[model samples]
Target chain A: MNILIIGAAGMIGSKLTNRLIADGNLGGKAIDKVILVDVVEPTAPADAPFATETMAADLSSPGVAATLVEKRADVIFHLAAIVSGEAEADFEKGYRINLDGTRFLFDAIQAADGYVPRVVFTSSIAVFGAPFPDAIPDEFHHTPLTSYGTQKAIGELILSDYTRRGFMDGIGIRLPTICVRPGKPNKAASGFFSSIIREPLAGQEVVLPVSEDVRHWHASPRSAINFLIHAATIDGEKVGTRRNLTMPGLSVTVGEQIEALRRVAGDNVVARIRREPDPVIMKIVEGWPRNFAPVRAPALGFRSETDFEQIIRAHIEDELGGTFVA
Target chain B: MNILIIGAAGMIGSKLTNRLIADGNLGGKAIDKVILVDVVEPTAPADAPFATETMAADLSSPGVAATLVEKRADVIFHLAAIVSGEAEADFEKGYRINLDGTRFLFDAIQAADGYVPRVVFTSSIAVFGAPFPDAIPDEFHHTPLTSYGTQKAIGELILSDYTRRGFMDGIGIRLPTICVRPGKPNKAASGFFSSIIREPLAGQEVVLPVSEDVRHWHASPRSAINFLIHAATIDGEKVGTRRNLTMPGLSVTVGEQIEALRRVAGDNVVARIRREPDPVIMKIVEGWPRNFAPVRAPALGFRSETDFEQIIRAHIEDELGGTFVA
Candidate 1:
């Protein structure tokens, strides 16, 4: 009935908030209240069908997580994290926010009396490193090459353990890179994957840092939201002890992505993606997961766009209001 | 070269200390000093060839890790952890000792300027849970079923990350169940596995909690010490970024272990094991790993006993002065 969305100011979190309000209910239950919290106060929607409260707080700070959960929301979506590049740059800050913050939230829930809410954690495909199989299997070991990936993997482990101990019903979804992300490009190493698509569609030239043959896994913002919702409502018992899962997505090379863009919005839009090699970005991208053969998340009813063309089209439909610059 | 051994009061730690003392050198360098630390003061060996310091300290305590690394030991063997049964019973204490203590030690190393010690971390097979393939592969995912397993898995992740970041030259060895552990019976769930072989040879009755058909992985204590020493001195560059490795071990069933005991110590000793089922222990043991195809450790010069009979004989020769009650 009640929901709490941490990191509700971020891209997927903001979109998910709008979608949940639009739907007016979750899992056949009418929404009673929605509380949005982020480091920066999230803009609350006007005249929503349900009660709304917005606040700014850092979950890593002492006593913040404990105070926030006093409302006893039926579901919690934890999406707050420093981006991969920033985490690598600031080691102490990364561990503080990503690792300690997540643990604080989980421990807070455990310390609470008779409260077992469904928790949806946003993990990443970064949990898997390079030198992958053709498609990384569900049983593939986590050997994260970056600090951000390591922190996320730790979060997944803690989530599973806490769930197994019956402290909370938690599901960690290892999201694929969200392609065609709607917003200005940020400093995330994976930002170029989305910006190359988003910026070009908006009639702006964007630099393609890596080579054309470089492959990566991707889903759209809409699909990522779908994953979070599904994870929140999924049956914990059926999911078993392995609560963390790699969400499905389209695996395509940069060249394939360009072709998909060409097919969706013509060669004019595709041509806007200029080639400019940045070796720093290239080296960082080298260690990322290219693809995954995730068996568990798909079986648990999580879905994503089938192809890169579908992903580009979803961005146009949802963020571009049924039209691109073309 | 100086060496620091944490948890030096424990079975493997003490044995490893004695072995190091006996050799008087590591990697062809003569031993300059040896520091042994634990929760309680470890018994110092009389007339050691090198300088030895034995002290009581809890690594999880504030400032303890920082102070311990002040000497900047060339090789640090971090073997400190609460046993599985105790960790399961006291969750907070388990996490404090196993997880936070390890992180503290690592972070302390990172904080020390120009001090990058070779760290040998003792992990466990508990990192891998049940529902395993016939032989768990090198890339098998960690899905620990207990609090202790969860803590150990976290340690392995941190070790690999720290090593990758260049803060320390670290190697984590996921040890198999130490068969024929030389000590009085303790409360660990896995204690029975050792007790069955240990107590029978001493003319004492020991309970066989699990069914004879239950198979598990094992290695002798001598092999464990050898793995530690090898890990401490091995080439870090050759180990690469995947610093944590599952040590190779023999896989055998309880029935097979009993047969090995009969062959090694005769029927009188084998008859000393009483058939008394423990539902709790059985449930706990059911989630442990039975076999592994550990490709990396063996290739990197890590080894263990080849057969269960060899494990029993190791106990007899090492702990029983080359004779048993039989």
Candidate 2:
């Protein structure tokens, strides 16, 4: 089986790539070839069992998607997008890279008529805006508040339409905020969700931007990668017309996350978290959905952590090699 | 105030144009100019109190929208789109005119460097797909079953995004089916909705293609025209970020429609209706919305007929000079 991973240079992309290589197969079929691509050149896996190619290409630019589609990878994972904070900051760049870029890829696939492939697109919970219900259902309408959310919602719409038209077999999964990220803090509005747990566990001080009561949906990086794999291998017929799905997630407040952190590590680790209210990020995050009643994903066999503790545990095991600063 | 109506030759567009001329004002402001456009050359009103210009322009064509936007009409009504059946029949034409054409107009306005006009976009209930509730709420997610619906939904998304970016002051109203339509039977799947009432009242035979229980939401052409004017005049501030809204309409079944027709045009006129079930058209109409809880539009002061009789009455008064063939 041949596989193609777009946006293969990102953390989740790299993790997914390594997982596929380690397994040496996908959906019980042996992985014979893999192509990794992003705006920046992706690194080829070392000592690989299959022929792997990595290249840098801007999807928004014409002809780039055509080249990728011409390769005719059996299963395509389109995870490339401008991040939320950056997309909102730069409107033109956001629309070009996220909206137009994704369109280019879909159109290129259509251009190669009769070469239908399984396309797994990464959408986000940002598609849901504020004034949300306590637990948003699977069929909640997308009223995006930010440019990033708008672009992602549009991506979902386009992918679903293309799939319906038989241009491709597509599934768009709206991911929850990933917690305990294994890296330095970024400028994302959701960064605090990860940083509070990740930094403290690593014996470093972290700032809490929002209040303790501020809640949001989350999953471990492991679940996210698993969602991608599951999406690629599932029976597309079962998804029916509603291809874009709100993924299952653990909805918890900052207090619960701290409690989970305190339980996992010692009190000393919990003390590393410093509360510093950021009204800007708080206001932005306030409009985000705190939870979802994602019946579709769960019924489709995609699972995630039930509690915040398991999420932090998964992060420790996956990102920290089963160890932390303690 | 200057006004621009794209697709001015269409039924709703023509009604809106004549209404604007009759009133000679919009939101209490004197109407001085009206630019009407469609795929075919629109007919300019003779001896109008305002300067009326009529022209034909394919908006999807490059530079067409730019010219219209450069003129900087203070209130622009974008009502151009292929019907649902036509869009389903012709995919490229649907996307070209509905999606790309709408985007062109928004982009053109943006390109003019901050010429933000009040853009009243006419959306439709077709945006909602099948397996719907008895009464679709304002928050219902759009999973359009047809290409025309998909294009309209996409147009709503684009206009909302553009509005958010300050490119234009926009409001999209999802109009219900206009019942008691004044014209010969067209090939539209929903044409029977109007034809059943119109043809019978005009001493012509009309086929009832579906069952008596098939329910749908509807309004009069006058109500549709009022919707456009209200969308133009309503304070955009009230709409906030979610600019697209489902318009109010009378929710009645085909049986109720026949009852209203019998009441209006007498039993003799209603006898002209012939029952002939069409599986194809029935399948299409089956996916339509039965009713709507358009909380937003009502809150914004947009109103429609409370009962189907009022709808039929409006058609007779407006189209038949206050009398029917009976």
Candidate 3:
């Protein structure tokens, strides 16, 4: 089986690629080849038994999607997107890449004629918006508050439509904010969730934007990758007409996260977190959903970490040899 | 005040135009100019007091949106769309006109260099999908089962984002299926609702596609026009961050509708209806929401006809001079 991973250089994309390579096949089929495409060239695995190819090209560019699909991938994981903050900040670029880019890819797959690949799309919980009752159920409206969320919601719609039309078999997984994302901090408002722990563990002071009681939903990077794999392997018939499902994640307040930090790394690491109270970020966070009742996804066999401590532990094991330097 | 109506040649669009022209203003603001645009020439009212300009151009085409906004419309009623059945039948055309067309108009308003106009977008309850409860609430999730619904949901998203960014003040009114729609019948799955009564009232036999027990949400054409106008004048602050609202509608089962027909035109007209069960239309209608709890829209001053008999009477009075030949 041949697999293609778009946005293969990014966090979840890279991890999924590595896992697929290590496993050698998805669902017992031997992997013949893997094509990795992204705007930035992906790091090729040093030791891979399967044939691997890498390409750095912007999928949003006209004809790029068709050209990429020319190789006829059996299964495609479209993980590319401009992050929420950047997409919101740059309106034209965001829609062009997120909306137009996804459509182009789907259309390209359809244009491939005889080939119908299983498509796994990574959607986001940003698709849900405010005035939400404490814990949002599986069937909350997709009234997105941001351009990023809107784009994700549209992507899910297009994916479902194309699948319904028999162009491709598609599954859209609406993932939560991935906590403790490894590597340098990014510009996303939710970055603080990671920075509070990541920066502090790296012996640096971090700012907490909102009050300790501010709550949000999250999953670890590992869980996100797991979702992608599961979505790719699962039977599309099981999803039926409802092609998108909100992935499960832990719901924790910033205060509880701080407490988790204290329990895991003691008072020193927790004390390194400073409260500056940036109202702009706080306001953005305010409109976001704090939790989701991912009943559909859980019933479909998708799983997530139960709490924040487990999230921190996963971060340590995956990124830092299960040790905190601070 | 200048008013712009996109898709002015369409069925509801023409009716709305006539109403607006007949009234001369909405909310007491005299409409000085009526810019009527569509892919086809609109039938302009001969005695329209306002200076009427007709432009037969597709809004989805490049620069069309900016050109429309350049005329400095104080209020825009965007009613353009490919019908549900047509859109579902043609994927590319659907996305291009519905999704990209809406996006272009939104971006055009934003690109107007700070000219913010009141944009009243006509959305649809088709945004909701299957496994729906008896009555869908305003908080229901957007799991659009069809491409048409998906496009509308995406349009709603863009509308909200543009509103939030202050590019243009947008209000998306999710209209229920307008029953007793005047004029020639089309291929919409819900057309039978109108056809059964419309044909029989004309002393013609009408075929019912599904069982009489199938219930669906509906509004009158007058009510639909009312929604557009109300959406134009209502205070955006009252709508807050969520720009889309489900318009108030009367939910009636097919049997109830036929009963109303019987009450209005006697059993003779109702007896002309023949029921040959169609699983195809039945399956499609099965996913549709039977009713809606439009609590938010009503509190904000939006209203609808209270009874189904009133709806039938309104149709007769407005379309058939309060009498049916049959």
Candidate 4:
């Protein structure tokens, strides 16, 4: 089996690549070749059993998707997108890469003759907007508040329609926020969700931008890779025409996340967290979905951490090599 | 007030054009100019109280929308789209016209300097698909089964996003199937809904493609025109960020519709209805929405026929000079 990974240089993309290489096979079929692509050149691991190629290409360019589609890989993981902040800040670039880029890729696949690949697209919970129910149901309508969310929602609609038309077998996974993000803290609105846990565990101080009661949906990086693999291998027939599925996630507040970190490590780590509320991020977070009663994904065998403690533990084991600053 | 009507030659568009001329004003403002555009040159009514201009333009072509947006009409009614049958049959033509055409228009509006018009976009109930609730609620998810529906749903997403970004003050009215369509019977799957009532009143036999119990939502052509005017004039601030709304429509089964016809035009007209079920049309109709519990439009002062009798009466009064064949 051959595999193609678009946006293969991002956080989840690199981890998914490593996981696939370590397994050496997907769905009991040996992976013979893999192509990794992104706006910036992605690295090809030296120890992979299969032939690996990595290249940099802007997907929104006119002929880029056509060339990529010509490869005719057995499976395609389309995880490429401009992040939420960047997309909102630069409207034209957002639509070009997120909307037009994805359309070009889908159209290229449709234009190819008798080549149908299992396409796993990464959508986001941002598709849902504010005034949400206590637990947003499986069939809640999309009323996106941000340009990024609007683009993602449009992508989901296109994915379903293309799949229904028999151009490709597609599955859209609407992922939640990734918690305990294994990197240096940044200034993203959502960065506090991860930094509060990551920095404190590393014996460093991290500022909390939102209040303790501010809640959001989250999953670990390991679960994200697993979700992609499961999506790549799941039976399309079972998904029916509604190809997009909101992945299961743990919904918790900042206080709960810090408590989970404290339980996992020690009080010293918990003390590293400083409560410094920023009203701007708080207002932004208010429009986000805090919980979801996702029925379809779990029923389809997609899994995730059941509690906040497990999310932090997964981050520690995977990102810290089973150790932390303590 | 200056107005622009895309697809001005269409049934609803023509009716809306005449209505605007008859009223001589909108939202208490005196009408000054009206621009009508379509793929075919639309007829300009010489007796209008405003300066009328008609032109032929394919909106999907690059730079066409830019020229139109330069006019900056106070209220723009975007009523153009490839019908469901044509859109489904020609996939490329459908996306090009329905999706790209709408996007170009919105982009052009955004590109303009401080030009924010009240854009009344005519969406359709086709945005919703089957396996629906008895009365699909306001928050029901969009799972359009056809490419045409997908394109319209995408248009709605763009309309809402653009409006929220202050590019345009837009309202998307999801109109139900128009009953008693004032034209000769066509082979379109949904045509039978109107033909069953229209043909009989015109002293001609008509085919009933589905069973008597098959139910669907509908509004008269007059209602559609009124809905457009209301949408163009209503308070956008009251709509919040959810700019798209399901318009109020009467939900009636075929048997009920025939009964209403009997009440209006007597048995002579109802007897002209022949029951010859077409399984192909039946299968197609099965995926359509049977009813809707539209709350937003009604709350916003948009109105429609409360019963099938009212729908048939409106057709008789408007299209048949207040008298049927009987």
Q: Give the alpha carbon lDDT tens digit for every residue of B1-326 in model 1.
A: 99999999998899999998889999889999999999999999996799999989999998999999998999999999998878888989999999999999999999999899999999988888779999999999999988888898888888888788889999999999898888899888888889999999999999999899989899999999999999988999888889899999999999999999999989999999999999998987887899999999999999899989999888899998999898
What stretches of model 4 exceed 4 Å from their correct place? none
Range of the 10 consecutive residues with the lowest summed lDDT in candidate 2 chain A: A317-326
**Candidate numbers sorted by DockQ from highest down:** 4, 1, 3, 2
**CA lDDT of every candidate:** 0.91, 0.89, 0.89, 0.93
lDDT of 1 at B100: 95
Give candidate 3's error at residue A45 in angstroms: 2.1
Output the chain A TM-score of model 1: 0.97
Top model number, DockQ: 4
What's the TM for model 3? 0.96
lDDT of 3 by residue, A1-326 (tens): 89999999988888888888779888788999999999988878878779999999899999999988997988999999998888988999999999889989999998888888999999998898778887899888887888889889889988988898899999999998888988897777788999998888877889898899998899999999889889988988888888999999999999999999889998988888899999899888888889888788999999999979999999989898978866
Q: Give the residue spans of candidate 3 off by over 4 A.
A: none
- Candidate 4: clashing pairs of residues: none
Query: Candidate 1 has what TM-score?
Result: 0.98
Clashes of each: 0, 0, 1, 0
The second chain of candidate 2 has a TM-score of 0.98
**What's the distance in Å from true for residue A232, model 1?**
1.1
lDDT of residue A234 for candidate 2: 96
The deviation in Å at residue A213 for candidate 1 is 1.6
Give candidate 4's fnat, 2 decimals: 0.87
- Which window of ten consecutive residues has the lowest lDDT sum in model 4 chain A? A317-326
Note the B-chain TM-score for every model.
0.97, 0.98, 0.98, 0.99
The root-mean-square deviation over C-alpha atoms between each candidate and the true structure, in angstroms, is: 1.3, 1.1, 1.9, 0.7
Measured on C-alpha atoms, candidate 4 has an lDDT of 0.93
Task: Kindly report which residue stretches of model 1 are placed more than 4 angstroms away from their true locations once superposed.
Answer: none
What's the C-alpha lDDT at position A193 in model 3?
Answer: 90
